[model samples]
Target chain A: MGDRERRVVFVTVGTTCFDALVKAVDSEEVKQALLRKGYTDLLIQMGRGTYVPSKDSGKLNLQVDHFTFSPSIADYIREASLVISHAGSGSIFETLRLGKPLIVVVNEDLMDNHQSELAEELAERNHLFCSRPQTLQETVEAMDLDALQPYMPGEAKPVVALINKFLGFPV
Target chain B: MGLDAFAAACCAIPVLASLLAVRFAYVLCRSGLPPTRPRAAGLRCLIVLGSGGHTAEMMNIITELQKDRFTPRYYVAALTDSMSLQKAQVYEKSLIQGEGEKIIKNAQFMQIYRSREVGQSYITSIATTLLAVLHALWLIIRIRPQVIFCNGPGTCIPLCASAFLLKVLGLGWSSIFYIESIARVKKLSLSGLLLYKLRISDQFFVQWTQLQQKYPRAQYAGRLM
Candidate 1:
């Protein structure tokens, strides 16, 4: 009979198959951690990954939901209190711009692993937390909300100004 | 006497061709060096949107553009990339809703031939690349956009090449602006490399300081994401 606001954690892997991160977050320990942190809902955008979360919905008191893909993940990201995502720049920047606390799980299976460079740089700047699949649990357990600084989204004014200047347009 | 004249003419032809080639190279190198050009009332802006992250970054930059000045925007995306075009359409729709229906009157979407497909062999890729270049040349000639803005993607190479050819021939002046993708924190993409090495872009921007340090010509734009 009582209704309360639902706190959600959104996990997304973009358009790639990252079963490692999906499976890591599906564990009982991670779900229990989310519950302890007062998060009531867990939504996962699995992308092409074949793994379906097997956690029981009734016993844990935490709602677990997932889908293969969506037309727009921004809506889900906006609804989430926290975000766990792959190191894809699109997801990382989107989450950061939305001012959500993010944990980026780098996919080691990717060739060249160029995604790590952006992740590490942002993480070093205290913009987001970076983790590997093996260390995601530890990251989830140890993440402190107070440690993050609000990210300032970049402006296109400089680039636009340069373009206007190059064309001899009035400043 | 006729045979002697013909032989002299043949030698002159090769010399003239070599001289012309040198002049062409000079013009290409000197392109994008002018501080300013004659201002126009309205400009044709050609925007190149690549797959995934490139498209997202470009959209971010485009949102900051002066919509009134850059009239009749042309969005170019790869034929195989459906999502980019869809995103462009959605963006235009939002603009229309906010401003009015007139905002989309001149906006157009163009699909270009992909230069190469994934897992395609190098031998066949060369042929496809040439075909794509020819298609792009035709598009460039028809569009004659005054300014071309592109980020990382193979699709932009042909279009940039065609625009550069026009600049060399003095047929049209399309100032090419190339922005290095943010995903490349340390290095430039292949398209970025060709644009930089060949000096095709009038304004080259890199999002990271390290990349700008490594490539002196590239101006660090401070993370335009």
Candidate 2:
């Protein structure tokens, strides 16, 4: 237990995926699985309860936290080992720009399946890993930062120059 | 057939023939012209006249054109005075800053005369059309452009009418009307119907293949953007 390293998962669920994540965290099967895997903490957000420590366990080693709105989300992304988030375009773009591994959960019922479409497109382009509820864990585990490095659009120079030239500016 | 019916049919023949003649002339003129040469020398200007989502798309095209040889000018008219005008200005400045040449050198926010009730829509449209016609006439007189291009909805009606009047009055410039994407999606609007009545424009650029089959006067420019 002392040798186990600490890792944080940053999650931002706008509206639709909030309930699903809560359900996943509340399930006994998921909690037991995490416990078995030596995971020390669970950050449950959007008014969900914390992971209760066992009677004989030392200091309730696993802790779950919640956040309504925190300005420190950007700082969290810099510090976190992995990011699990909704498939919003802004979030996806920012995460990719920062060179971080992302596990995007698509909200099916919103905006004519735009999130799903965007996620699938990014996946096809090998930019990021995407999943629905059933395969979220697998998708998260499958996210290889090294493989994603090749796909990330490195610098903003090319796109910026293209836009500028289109606007009738000298390249 | 009765005498009145015979007389009516006689009147229809010339109308149909004249329509056919216009169609033939358009086809012949378009076919004879060469492909749009990228490096063709002249200050080629594309004037876009709409202020909405369509205008945003047009801005994208203008941006693309700025990268190329054509110089683009945007003339925006809309029912509301919201963020679209600001967006256009931003795009204009950004393009100028980046290119060191003004792609959208001239942009005007034309006023839209609004109507509250359904009945007033017609009156509103007529007044707006007349105002636009006068404005376009002045612009043509001042600028004396080589070609006037129109992407339709509200702005096309008056601009096309002004262009036709200029042509009829013996002005040497040519005009091209670009039918909007919505016309391809569904039936023509009231403005489109009115544009059909003009009858003297140099060319009609339509997206649909069926438009060419129905009205042979329309040149199939594929998609302008």
> Evaluated with TM-score, which candidate comes out highest?
1
Interface RMSD of each: 1.7, 11.7
Give the clashing residue pairs of candidate 2, or none. Answer: A168-B99, A169-B98, A169-B99, A170-B99
Tell me the TM-score of each prediction against the true structure. 0.89, 0.42
| Error in Å for residue B54 of model 1 | 1.9
Off by over 4 Å in 2: A1-85, A88-91, A152-171, B1-70, B75-88, B95-105, B108-225
Per-residue lDDT of model 1, residues A8-57, tens digit only: 99999999999999998898778888888898989999999999986466
Give the per-residue lDDT of model 1 (tens digit) for B1-225: 999999999999999888779868876767666545568657888999998888988998888887888878999999999899999999988999888879998699999998898769999999998889999999999999888999998899999999888877778888899999888888788899999998989899999898999999998867777
After superposition on all CA atoms, what RMSD does each candidate show versus the true structure? 2.8, 11.7
- How big is the positional error of residue A153 in model 2, measured in Å on the Cα after superposition? 3.8
Which consecutive 10 residues in model 2 chain A have the weakest lDDT in total?
Answer: A47-56
Per-prediction fnat: 0.60, 0.00
